[model samples]
Target: MTTTARRGRPRGEGTDARILEAAHELLLERGYDGYSIDEVAQRAGVAKTTLYRRWPTKDHLIVAVVAKIQDDVPVTDTGNIRHDLVTYLEAIVAGLDRMRRVGRGREPGDRSAGLVAEIVAAAARHPDVGQAVRAVFARRNALPLALLESARARGDLNPDARPDVIFDELAGAVYYRLLITGEPFGGDYASRLVDQVLAGARTPSPRAERS
Candidate 1:
């Protein structure tokens, strides 16, 4: 299907950008429950019918905003896997921190990070949302996965190392620390995370040392 057919806007047009920007700003200010789609349309200076024609629902708009946020982070192969991964993690952490400062309306302390936590819950509850979430991640994850694979091929990582597992570990650690443990990541967190993941598994096996 064509891009226009799917979303009612040509992929490069600025209407989508304006809508997302408005939605993101409002979300940070008022959180998930505080704003409505009509407010977003009004803020963007677009008609409500036009916005609905594209997003169809508020949840879809949320996904689009998140997608834009993820898409803004640049991914380049600088040949230094550690540096690249650290840069990416740092950006992700900074972005998430911005989103997490305000919780949902009722719970001031909600660790779910507002929009992200909402989408995660929505994805779990509704299969369609889950599909959309999967699509978003799949697009976002491709680059990092490729970076890991390149590092492995270049001998920067173990020959036996699985990029997917390592990717999960790195991302999982960050999310777990933020959402589950509520621990704050310091300025050096990205460097520390990269060093630990790379150094711990690049060569030695603890079992081998013991045996």
Candidate 2:
């Protein structure tokens, strides 16, 4: 049996954008604990009911903010697989580092993950939040995966190379450092990671070697 679809008024893009922007700003300022739905409504100039209609909980709003942050990261494919991967990985590293600093007054060498840890914990505690978080990562990571596949198709990478495996190695290392090891990852580290991944997965072409 099929159920009838219920239709309602379409939400305005402008309102959604404003709410997300307010939420993101507040998340960076107060982190997950201090982030208040009332404050977000006030900042966005939206009604509490209206905000709730869009995001039923603060966790949902925060996850949406994370999704927006991931969307803001650009994935470039300039035909140079190594350079492109390195650029994209560096961007991810920069974004993670920024997230690690949210709501914290720590120094440059701070190992604490800050708001990132909060996001991870929230996602872990709630299945819906966890699913949303995974969806955002999958959506964002598809770009790089496609890039790797394209490189493989163009003979730049080894025939036996798996894009998923390579990406896990690259991205996983950064996340592991952020979530588990509490180590800092920078652009230089991203560059080296890309080099290592490509060196193993890429073909023995002079062009690949040059990268």
Candidate 3:
């Protein structure tokens, strides 16, 4: 007689969404340290085991929330690198600004990184969390990277324009302001950033072109 292979029970529909929604709300209401997996389970109306089965650790769950935020932004290619880059960067700025407000009671124009700072610190403190955070960024950046590649191929960007370097310039400025200088990532900054980056990366006119 042959034994039948055992199969795990399927997850209940909407359980993950409920958990994520609860976690996101709690994260915004309370800072990262103030929230707990048990609180998430209680708010989500799901068992702690259910939450763990999906997210092995609290850091893992937090990374998942951050990933969701990243996934919500759209990256488009309209055959115009400047417009596309500006639009994409503006979306990223919006996400960062939103995350910056989470669990903070600062006045308007505050430049605090808030939960984003906690995320970075968590990643640094835990190797697995660092890998998870890096993976999230790597996956999220693929679209913008592809958009740059398309622009380069279409002659819209300079032949020497490196997408990774260009991305570093664009994203680094935002993070620098958020995490270091505490400068306001105000409106129009995205436009200015795109203009500067594209100006350096655009093909020069024949009159100004060097051999």
Candidate whose lDDT is highest: 2
- The runs of at least 3 residues in candidate 2 whose Cα sits more than 4 Å from the true structure, single-residue gaps closed, are 1-18, 21-36, 43-45, 203-211
Model 2 weakest lDDT span, ten residues long: 1-10
lDDT of each: 0.79, 0.83, 0.81
Clashes of 3: 0
CA shift of 200, model 1, Å: 2.7
The residue-by-residue lDDT of candidate 2 on 89-162, one tens digit each, is: 88889988887775536677778776677778778877888898988889889999999999999999988888
TM of each candidate vs. truth: 0.79, 0.78, 0.81
Show the colliding residue pairs in model 1. Answer: none
Error of 1 at 50 (Å): 2.1
lDDT of 3 by residue, 55-138 (tens): 877888988877987888888888877888888889888888887775547677777787778778778877888899899999
Number of colliding residue pairs in each model: 0, 0, 0
By the TM-score metric, which is better: model 1 or model 2?
1
Q: What are the per-residue Cα lDDT tens digits for candidate 1 across 1-211?
A: 3334547445446778898878877776676567899999999987776788789877798788768778877788999999899999998888777677643353655565555665576678767767887899899999999999999898888887788988888888888877678787899998898898988658754566674
In angstroms, how far off is 186's CA in candidate 1? Answer: 0.7
